[model samples]
Target: MTDEADPKGLIRESYRIEGISTGECRSIFVDWALSLGPAMTPPAAIALLIARYAAANPGHPMNAVLSDGLEAPPEARRRGGRAARVAG
Candidate 1:
């Protein structure tokens, strides 16, 4: 798998090479990436979910909707405890 950071950087490079704006290239790359994922890792899963949610909701802000409600990753949760429920 490609590094997550690299894809983001490639998106920026693609914009420069193709003469598109950064926003336009990012949108294109995001759309493409979201389509391919089964999202094995928590971060990847979150990213895919956010992308799909954003595509569907458009003007609605997903982070505001999820920020406080979602549990932190197991690694981030206190004391290596069981996973917490994320209320969505």
Candidate 2:
């Protein structure tokens, strides 16, 4: 199955296979940011955590479900937004 079809499982598996703690994961994410450009601020790191959590739980109720006539944030929307658009 694809990541979208089983994000939580993918995350758990990734963590297990990588032998990395959540803290380590967060640190690596920050390291990646630093390597790409500048050091990551606390706010940026928190945002990255939130984003990674969401990515690792795409089918989660909070991520997948929406109230009638209510729209998710542009970031959370399934299509034509930054993450999905970029992935596509």
Candidate 3:
């Protein structure tokens, strides 16, 4: 049942790892997101992952991380630049 969305099985393995922490799940989620091809939307991939694994383990911490991915992404914010430095 491995899907192209999770080609490396990182998300799937996260589900199987007992006592995995939220921080670890977040790191794994980032890795999984970065692995997606340009054609794959993170929301679509995350929805698929939740459907595939969440039902079996409603308590998994990965579920929260994946669910968090579904949120509207924060708008890009500039951190540092000549303008920022000048303003500061």
Off by over 4 Å in 2: 1-17, 38-88
Instruction: Name every residue pair that clashes in candidate 2.
Output: none
74: Cα error in model 2, Å: 18
The lDDT per prediction is 0.44, 0.40, 0.89
Tell me which of candidates 1 and 3 scores higher on TM-score: 3
Give, for candidate 3, the lowest lDDT window spanning 10 residues. Answer: 79-88
lDDT of 3 at 58: 88
Candidate 1 achieves a global lDDT of 0.44
- When sorted by lDDT, best at the front, the candidate numbers are 3, 1, 2
Q: Poorest 10 consecutive residues of model 2 by lDDT?
A: 61-70
Best by lDDT: 3
- Please state the error at residue 17 of candidate 2 in Å: 4.8
Model 1 Cα lDDT, one tens digit per residue, 1-88: 5544333343324423534554554465555445443425435544644554545544433333323224564565453334444433
Model 2, span 1-88: residue lDDT tens: 5233222343234334434455554444434434432344434443444466657654433322212113333574456558765854
Models, CA RMSD each: 13.0, 16.1, 3.3
Candidate 1 local Cα displacement, residue 68, angstroms: 7.3
